[model samples]
Target: MSLDVVVEHSVSLGRLWSEDGLDIMIAPTSVVVADALITWNVNLQWVCDLDYVPDQERPLDLVAFAAPCLWRRRMIAALVAAGREHRVALSSHSVTALQAAIENGLGIGLLPPESVRTGSMRVLKTSAGVPEPLTVQYGLYAHDRRTPVVDAAIDVLLKDIPATPGP
Candidate 1:
């Protein structure tokens, strides 16, 4: 239940993260550790402060989440390979606290497509209009095909959150 940054980015070991080489990995996901799997058409809004605006009138900041799992770890590795890791901070803080911080101008946050809200935050345009998205293509894999919990978890994920397009 942690992030696996730099895992299998340079080369694939096809083993558990607990194995000799993969130990350095095993990072968990959050707004602090890794890049999120955004849509290819993701329109990132710059989460900033509304200092001059009234508190009661200020808009809510966007927030999103991703559970820690094997497929997610591979995604982090892919991000590292593409040189897009750490685009924003991901931490263990509560979502409300994180969103408030962003609303207070801590910095921009990359939210999932469904969480996007363009009220107060202004969109950031890449050189090509849309910024590149974090990789989200892998599923679960283990040192041995007979691994128990991993496959079951993967099965659950397969049914829970199917990867979708950005808003």
Candidate 2:
């Protein structure tokens, strides 16, 4: 029998075994860490801006993706652990949407380091209580019955994706 498979993000792997048809899974050895970049509007907070003040403290309006996403979950956990107070100014499922909100001066956002644009926004070294960092894991699931095709596919994937670097 030909096995069907689909690959996507944010899938609930815990429920895979309960399903009838799935036979196998291949996954990352460990979670990948994404450092949050605390970005802000250059125009509003720039050193030369009329409203800017040296060493000023202001309440942070935090922007984040909707719940159930690993990034958002980790961000919240870090904030709670650090005893930081924040208001959720915006919640979105898209990283682009979150970026847009930040660019528009809605609030500071917790985003993947790669997504931050240095040209339009400045990454703050420190915020009121910026969390350490966040990570998310990826996994592949397959049934107990493995075919040659499945084995080959797994082999290819392993070869293509580099192993996670050590701390």
Candidate 3:
């Protein structure tokens, strides 16, 4: 048996299903769930820098995903609801770039747990008056009718879920 994996932003992953080009996708529920079947989800932790303070005299600066990324939109909405303001100092579609920017102290960012560096950043908590970031509900999705290849792929991915980072 052979397996093919495609790494893409969530917006592009949503399009793969309609073209019949994808057998399975592991993505956030907000991105691709409407037509999927046999879905399983895990709650991932959303993390940010420990030293970054919110609601300072000035708007918080952010290093974030680009306009097409759902994380950016979600983070902005959550901050707004909490009566906090922010500016996007840097934006990119690449997770690696976001990590680098956050590490260099360009601005705070909402990052997947795995992308966070232990010494450089920490998970955001309520102490700073920052609203909790959106829940990271990522789902494993498959089409209604599964082929053997698709089934095997799902089995492998299910077995390979990464351990969440520790605080």
Candidate 4:
């Protein structure tokens, strides 16, 4: 009986948090009982320091969207095809999760450049090419996509674009 709580894409939530300084809770995975007001993601990339593990081989894999990924898989696949080992073992539960994985030596994960709050993560420099960034979109979602609450929430969510560290 309440429409005050709206479900929105993580991108929108990230942007909203950046702009309004509010905290955010990630959307639930493995459930699609409702539709979204929007269905897009915000694009981003993962960069790693070349010297972190000079002799270590990078694994070309993808982290979960729940991980720090905004949209990192596309580039990761290409890297794999090119014989570069880089990517994560699994999608992370959150950006925090992705950062933890990196800190724990799991692998680099994708995230907005600006979102990198500490020296714990750094932008990567490919030996012979520019970094490949991914595009993600944000959506205002609801259990019933046709509801006015969903519509208004979508508008509110789309009002601002999020920021990143940069490619």
Top candidate on TM-score is: 3
Write one digit per residue (lDDT tens) for candidate 4, span 53-131: 4234434444445523335445566566666655457674466666666655555656766665456656654653424
Candidate 4 similarity to native, TM-score:
0.51
Per-candidate Cα lDDT values, in order, are: 0.37, 0.51, 0.71, 0.48
TM-score per candidate: 0.36, 0.58, 0.80, 0.51
Q: Which candidate ranks first by lDDT, i.e. highest?
A: 3
Cα displacement (angstroms), candidate 3, residue 48, comes to 4.9
Give the CA lDDT, 0 to 100, for residue 64 in model 3: 82
CA lDDT, candidate 3, residue 98: 83
In candidate 3, what are the lDDT values of residues 1-167, reduced to their tens digit?
77788987788887886576788887776776454333443433345565655556778788888887777788888889888878899999888898888777677788766677989777767666567655665666687788887888777776776533211
| Candidate 4 whole-model C-alpha lDDT, 0 to 1 | 0.48
Clashes of 2: 10
Better of 2 and 3 by lDDT: 3
Give the deviation of candidate 4 from the true structure as CA RMSD.
9.1
lDDT of 1 by residue, 1-167 (tens): 55344533212333334344432322222211223232222232333344412122332222222334333344344435644433333432344554565565654444444543445444343331223544333222223333455555544544654444312
Q: Which ten-residue region of model 3 has the weakest summed lDDT?
A: 36-45
RMSD per model, one decimal: 11.4, 8.9, 4.7, 9.1
Ten residues in a row with the worst lDDT in model 1?
Answer: 25-34
